[model samples]
Target: MTMADDTDRYGRVSRVLHWGMALLILWQFLSAGAHFLLGDTAVEEFFWATHKPLGLLLFVLIFVRVLWALMNVSRRPQSVNAAAKAGHIALYMLLVIVPGLALLRQYGSGKSFEPFGIPLFSGFEGDETPWMVAPGDLLHSWLGWVLLAIILGHIFMVVWHRRSASQPDVLPRMWR
Candidate 1:
């Protein structure tokens, strides 16, 4: 198999990042769902604990994915149209923004954060940084759901394109 993307299909690394992020996003949503719908339960406890660390993981993965995409841009398969291209751009933006806001809030909370024992932030003394905390508090969950909606739309577009006679079956670019 090819290690780099071609005009017709994604390379191994691209496919791994794409699908890997997809799965992580799905798990993130599940954690959020449990927190929301199954509050104060073991299910929520199990899933919610992973939310922050996984969000941090995703934040890092997205940057790597973005750089990879940029590096492979010229050789990658073409987007179906302006809308498809725009949709992808939107996806990438949300992927960055959602976790970014959360990380901001985390730093603002005046608490140490050591995801997977990496020691990302050491707690600071004095009052918490409200400015940093506020944006993430206000937008993190909201943008996350928005991200979910957009992802669903993306999946729909893919399926629609595959089933429709007018468009190409684009899944093979990443899947096959």
Candidate 2:
């Protein structure tokens, strides 16, 4: 199968990354939703347990995806318009920013973080850094909700475009 993206459809690598991240993002949202709506319950506990590690995984995957996208930028299917291009750029930004903020707060919390046993951060002594923690505390959850809203809008636009007679049905470009 083709591995590099072209004008017709996403290549094998891109499709795999896209769909795989889609499933992971769906799970991430589920965990977030459970934490927000089912606090102190078994459901929350079950989903929340995977939140941090999965977020780390997503951050890593998005990093790779970004690199791959850049490598194939000249060949990939074009964005339907300026708004679609901006929407995608926004998605990429949020994908990086949201988890990056969490990672910052995690390190600043003076706690060790070894997601998937990678030993990423070692715990530190002393109070957590206010500057590092504050941005996450103030913006992480809020921005997470905002990301979800944009994701929903992204989905809506996909369907809307598919149905509009004048707009291209773009799903197949990414889907297969």
Per-model CA lDDT versus the true structure: 0.94, 0.93
lDDT (tens digit, per residue) of candidate 2 on 1-176: 59999988899999999889889899999999999999999999999989999999999999999999999999999999999999989988998999999999999999999987889989999999999999999998888888888899999999999999999999999874
Query: Can you give the lDDT of residue 168 in candidate 2?
Result: 95
Instruction: Estimate candidate 1's alpha-carbon lDDT, on a 0 to 1 scale.
Output: 0.94
Candidate 1 TM-score versus the reference = 0.98
TM-score of 2: 0.97
In Å, residue 119's CA in model 1 sits off its true spot by: 0.8
lDDT of 1 at 44: 100
Question: What TM-scores do the predictions have?
Answer: 0.98, 0.97
